[model samples]
Target: MCPVTVFEQDGCDLRVEWGLDGVHALGPHCAVLVVVDVLVFTTTVDVALGRGARVLPLPWRDERAAAMAEALGAVLTPPGLDESYGQPGWTLRPSSLTDLPAGTLLGIASPNGATLAAAAAETGTAVLAGCLRNASAVAAAASAIAEDRPVGVIAAGERWRPERTLRPSIEDYLGAGAIAAAVTGRSAPSSEATLAAVSYRAVRDRIPALLGGSISGRELIAAGVPEDVALATDVDVSTVVPVLDNGVFTS
Candidate 1:
């Protein structure tokens, strides 16, 4: 029992941790891993899945992303709206996929959510995309996948630019908390997980305002994409649980 292993939350039926470190720490011990990137990533997945699109999560700036999309015959989502590429296709922004058609295969990239998700998948456990939009649904789906085994929820917090260090965001905390709260009664949760749920419950009704004023939310608003923040804070409005299958998320 290395002291570091204590972070794995061993013996807990539900555990919560933050960022890529969390995935690596708890992924192997849990039967199911839920990645929550509420400001965008997982929210985007929920929006796309709800619209019937299959989403392939790719690490941000992965050189193989284009090749992988080509190999899978999926549309490689643009990194973001570029004036040079007028009317660009889907992007990491949740609202960008609102018109995604049914049966579309989209490869989406992210530094946080997708990176955490890919790391979790390496542990060979079931991986799910969780967010505020689909919190309850993802919790139910993850519980079913775990079948009483441990379920690890990773809040995919943003990276500090340049150095790329983890910057925990309140939005993701609430998103993870929302899912953890949904599983409160049935699963024995770690203290970390329980705190998240408690925090979420304390501000459940003010989620929209809290998210809008959160650092990540403010960033999106400053970037003129406030709708993304609004969309991500919908709070259990979607029932679609984007489960990762064969490296792609399909409801």
Candidate 2:
């Protein structure tokens, strides 16, 4: 057997890994894939879905994002955040989605979460968005969807700028841990998954503060969107589970 196969945690009912590489390693072996990008991507999805909006996850720099949104009749989110903070229009910021009307179709873009979700979708596995706001809900949904099959959780870590390499973000790990901890009773979790859950439980009370101080959260705060971090850290406030179906996330 290939060494890569060892990392799959094939015998476990629940698995966890970070980034797109995790998806490539574990997507094939799992029945459900949960993508966690707590800083923004998945958190935005939860908020939007809770308000009865559907989301189309798109790559951050994909030139086709607008065209694809037009083709799907969805509102394409702005690619840049030049003037999005505290504005009405949608970007990756979760606060802008507060008043999002029902039945809206939003094409949300991200470098981490959206990319991992799109990759997991290609594996033909069921993909669900998980984040701090809706961690418990997503965990239950993913567990039920798996139906005794393995479920893989992918933490969409931030990219180191300039080089754009993976920079594992604590917020994403904690979000993944939240979901994993929720489902621990239903399935046997891999060691990676267990560590995440344990870490989350250890800091469950300080999530908001930790998230605000995190590298990703600090960046957002410095960018004039502190509300984004605040909203993202609203643990268990949302019960929405945004599942990716046919290239869109609804309910």
Candidate with best TM-score: 2
Question: lDDT for every model?
Answer: 0.85, 0.87
Clash count for each candidate, listed in order shown: 0, 0
- TM-score against native, each model: 0.94, 0.94
What is candidate 1's local distance difference test score? 0.85
Model 1 lDDT per residue over 128-185, tens place: 9999989999999888888878988899988887798999999999999999998633
Best by lDDT: 2
Q: Write the per-residue lDDT of candidate 2 for residues 166-205, one digit (tens) a residue.
A: 9999999999999999974455778898899899999999
What value does the lDDT take at residue 145 in candidate 1? 80
- After superposition on all CA atoms, what RMSD does each candidate show versus the true structure? 2.3, 2.0
Candidate 2 TM-score over all chains jointly: 0.94
Lowest lDDT 10-residue stretch of candidate 1: 79-88
